[model samples]
Target: MYVINKSRHSAYLLHAHIVFVTKYRRNVLGDLHLDAFKTSAAEVCAEFDAELRECDGESDHVHLLIEYNPKVQLTKLVNSLKAVTSRRLRNQFTDLRAAYDKPVLWSRSYFVGSCGGAPLEVVAQYVRNQRG
Candidate 1:
């Protein structure tokens, strides 16, 4: 079930699922890296007044489910998440830093999908049935 959240002026429910792949799709992440990433990601989300609801990953990629206010600019949040995580992870993990001569962690691209609330088709049908 989705819960409605509120700010001083509005109430809303918004969520997004995001996926970030390692640069070159490298399988460099281990348990420690994944843990650190969760921590780092949660902090970043909090900075944007969002919540990181869920996070998990494999060696090459990670998934994040974030609940955010409608006012948040997702692209900016994503860029910050990628940049901050890259810098933090590289500095903390020597092997990760050494794994690449170039200073890079995640790829330049990412996947993001809006989620939660009613399905699009369901909402569309409801709208079509409206008397007005």
Candidate 2:
């Protein structure tokens, strides 16, 4: 059930599993916060011609599965997602903003894993068996 994307010259499929943790590992997110994050994440992914396949989280961290185009720079997308979500959440929930002196929601670092591709060993074996 993987659909390949075609550009003017190339075809590819790319996905990223990203994780963001709350600043100081605070347990501030609840149902309302998670819902808002999902909505905002979908909108942000749309801007980059990507799709947010799934999103879920606990009180302290969130996870997102995104299918995206190869042209998108992973780092920039992650930064934007964090910044936009943080700003929106802080504005929507005054109590959340009050918990921090500075405007911060997610920690500075994040986890991003590339997914949806042939296994590494399989690809390597194929290359080794190449005629030329």
Candidate 3:
């Protein structure tokens, strides 16, 4: 479940579903790097006063459910998250880095969408829903 954040001027519960894929669609992520990746992403979120509520990913891409302040620009957050996480992940896993032909870990493109109105659980379920 998620909670609302309130300040002197406004109360909000803005959530962004962010997806980032590996460069050239390389399948390099594995179980060993997941925890480290999550910790690094959470740290990035903290820098911008956002909360990393949920994070999961397949071998080639990742999904982040982040609750953020309205004052934060969504694009900058995504860029930092990708930059920080990729740098850390690459630094931690030398083998994984060599596995890719390019030095960059992630691609230039990403997907981000906001959730609203519905209960937190429903929105979360929608994010976790599988595409068939």
lDDT of 2 by residue, 1-132 (tens): 888999999999999999999999999999999999999999999998999999999999999999999899999999999999999999999988987989999999899998878988998999999997
Ranking by lDDT: 1, 2, 3
Best by TM-score: 1
Q: Which TM-score value belongs to model 2?
A: 0.94
lDDT of 3 at 90: 87
34-104: candidate 3 lDDT, tens digit per residue: 78889999999999999999998988999999999989999999999888888898899997789876668
Error of 3 at 90 (Å): 0.9
lDDT of each: 0.96, 0.95, 0.89
Separate clash counts for every candidate? 0, 0, 0
Q: After superposition, how far is residue 18 of candidate 2 from its true place, in Å?
A: 0.6
How well does candidate 3 match the true structure in TM-score terms?
Answer: 0.85
Q: List the residue pairs that clash in candidate 2.
A: none
Q: How many pairs of residues in model 1 come into backbone collision?
A: 0
Task: Give the higher-TM-score candidate: 1 or 2.
Answer: 1
Candidate 2: what lDDT?
0.95
Residue-level error in angstroms, candidate 2, position 9: 0.4
**Segments of candidate 1 deviating more than 4 angstroms:** none
- List candidate 2 stretches off by more than 4 Å: none
Model 3 ranges with Cα > 4 A deviation: 119-132
